[model samples]
Target: MSDKPYQDKAVIVTGASSGIGRALALRLADQGAWITLAARDAARLAVLAEECRQRGGKAIAVPTGVTGEAQCKALIERAVAEFGRLDVLINNAGIGATGLLEELPDLTLFKRVMDVNFYGVVYCTYYAVKHLKQTQGRIVNISSLGGKSPLPYNSNYNASKYAVHGFSDSVRMELAQAGVSVTLICPYWVVTEFHERLMDKDGTPRGPQGRAIYSEKTMTADQCAATTLKAAARRKREVLMGPGWLTVWLRIIAPGLVDKITIEMVLKPLVRRAEKTQSKE
Candidate 1:
């Protein structure tokens, strides 16, 4: 808990059923913030809400799929109705897409990724803005390092995060005048269920690439959550986790060098490992 406890402050955390959202929700609850846990998984959300309650904060579960405008609006309304007012909106709900764009047999995967990762944030923020402005609240966007630098073989995911970055940048300025802070959370690679949800063909998980991303070269959700909450409290314009701070600048300093390292560390290796897995399976 911070020195300045949230007490009765209301916070809504989308994707709170699991991963970083769950961790952040718990942290906020410990800081005495009233919490609304939102996700499509009702069972999981209920469990999380209970955990928040155990931490000594008021909490409710709102099972939500952020792709719909109506649902997003309802989520904000419910939070206000439950807690009397809204203080923060954390747009942490997102899906992942890995593997080469050309190899993806289902083109709809592109749209679905954008719908959840990009449009979900847009819908939730659009509805929550009124309450946020009313409270001089904060908008925390859980973006990715893909938003900052190139992520090879994951073009759709990259594009969606880049969209998120653009949207947050525009709104951060717009909301600044209103005293509602907008924060873009750019995490490099988080160990979470997101990669498992990255479907390839017919809802099958993208094989080795997803496995590699989750099991290797990733930061824990708790660490990411702690960083995110601190940033939100500080009303930071943007926060980049892990290697993002160095890597994003490195891209500007040495694009060609970065491209060469990316190919070696990411592109070729992922393709090779995925192909090898396919052969074995």
Candidate 2:
């Protein structure tokens, strides 16, 4: 790519406390970008900020909840104040849960996930668009495999990601004339705290699905982050990485066949495990 684009640019990464977000922030910082780290966990954000600063780039922590438009705007404002202008905004703050839709004890978490995953993206983009237009900047949204293809146990997460995928695509078209690039990074099963945070209806950590998926093939957060930065530098409209990319085309070409494989490979085994656990209980 044409001589590293991040140097001396202002980039904001939500969910910067850990995982792909943190990896991206550090990677960008190493390239001399002034990094704004945004996340709900203030302490972890602070730690990451220091780490970024030590990496030979400027860094700051903005404790933000993307669910609120005001906070999202504030995040941009802080970035501009610190770095003079914003070049990239990564909408990556999100969370999810695991349970069958029929078994979920409360629907509130569904809304929570949507508010954070989809609406959070909308809020950040709504505020970032103006500055991006001026800088002719890029907006990258961290979507998921779930966005393109729904997963077995994560109905709420699938909906939220699908919304993100839809929203990012529509805006990418609208903002083209304005010279702002919108890129969506869709990956499957990276190593992250995502699974540990996902809860069952009973408030307990969910079962082995995440682990099972990882056991098959999981990308490291740093690897995903590097791919994202590389894609963003080229201003690619969309980047789909990992084995999950195959499933998307399979779903399009032979949906019934894909569904049958999903049933046998993923759904049935997980369902049997659940049944066994319930019987023991």
Candidate 3:
């Protein structure tokens, strides 16, 4: 391995408009990586591309919504065409919803979350796998701690990440023989725009004003990006970031106990607040 492992590498970062994806792009750029910035926001992607260039990495903005298979294929093709090869693919695009499954107005919330979070990863990886094989590259999936354990009011989000967890793990085994590495990143609550994108019970985006229970102990997007980059560089199989790993272990040793703890420590407060907010409305 080289001291500057990412130097001159061709990397594609989905959801590059903001949050963890944006942070990852900038950090990769600083490492001299050729970055392909993909997001729904063309304006933001273009701006980020320029910033990457200023940091010494070549970059291209490929405006994309990962929900469509054709778009994902095109994204992979564009990155390979521009950079001559694909060294890394980061599946960081995701969305979330907050509410009990029974509370949602329709199943659209579940479908939408699955489409963006699970299918988006599937589409991008399916397209990029062959290219990555040629370069013996890396695939990084950004998941959540909620994926590993049950969290009330996040059934849709949890299901999506759970799908990602299983898919990524299975794919990693399949790609092991080809020298292509897959890394699953399960990070705890991070200070990002995720809360803004979180949907409420009525199938509407929560926006910035949405009331979310956040822990004072949180990691910044930059911190998450740095940690993820390190894990990907090392070709780690899976990593659990922050204290959230406890739930994963406890779930294994004492599933019922963990469930009770989760309900008491996290779910009850959320349900209480949701009820209060509803009463006012």
Candidate 4:
């Protein structure tokens, strides 16, 4: 068996307060890596850190908002100061906003979604790349299947993830000679508190109409996290999770065919139902 890549390494995970981030933190901690947990919720992060310690792994919680560059830099600095070296950076912090592009009132909602989902990854990567290059480390970006295949009523969310896929691909090519590997984890509908936290600029829930659909295909956060860690350790380029791979592959083979099926089978039904619900109200 190959040696565990996480052993004796210092790792950082953003969005570590809950969901996949929390699970990834605990998983890495269990593997004997020193973990730095970054998220906006201090209380939740503290609790997660304690749990990591209980699991016999070193963990430090640093409440962070990945939307800003300074905070992203601080997160990296704190991790390096605590562990003296950084080996992995997991850009897992993200948010989703849903609405028909025409229905969104202004550009504000779109910008906010892009800021967190796209710029957050950019900021974290900007800071983490230097340390990673030094260690010939790894970067695992938490993209989504939506990144590869567009979904209905979530145009903004899909755009951000698509950007992630492109950016990761480009960087992965550049980092190849440096011995640093970049991996993208594309997951489909994981069961997490993500929707609860998803919001528009005014802090209203983004997609109440689609909650039932989300619940149907959702995998547990732990399952996603475990798969992500395994892929990262193996230094794989891309790992697509969930039962949606068939659709994704179909899209790869025939974009127009997949688009027609999605629009006809999924989007039309959803739009019709939404219209009926509105008429009833």
**For each candidate, C-alpha RMSD in Å?**
2.2, 1.9, 1.4, 2.3
Most TM-score-accurate candidate: 3
Q: Per-residue CA lDDT of candidate 2, range 1-281, in tens?
A: 55667999899999999889999999998998899999999999998899888988899999999999999999999899888898999999888877778887778877888999999999999988888898999999999988987778788899999999999999999999988999999988888877767776554765556555466357889999999998888889888877666889889999998888888988888788878988999
lDDT for model 2 comes to 0.88
Off by over 4 Å in 2: 207-213
- Give me the runs in candidate 3 sitting further than 4 Å from their true place: 210-216
Candidate 3 local lDDT, residue 156: 92
Candidate 3: residue 231 lDDT (0-100): 94
Per-prediction TM-score, please?
0.93, 0.94, 0.96, 0.92
Top candidate on lDDT is 3
Q: Candidate 4, residue 262: CA error in Å? A: 1.2
In model 4, which range of ten residues has the least summed lDDT? 206-215
Model 3 lowest lDDT segment of ten: 208-217
Model 1 lDDT at residue 208: 49
Instruction: Output the worst ten-in-a-row residue range by lDDT, candidate 1.
Output: 208-217
For 28-79, candidate 4 gives per-residue lDDT tens digits of 8788889999999999999999999898789999999998999999999999
TM-score of 1: 0.93
In order of listing, the candidates' clash counts read 0, 0, 0, 0
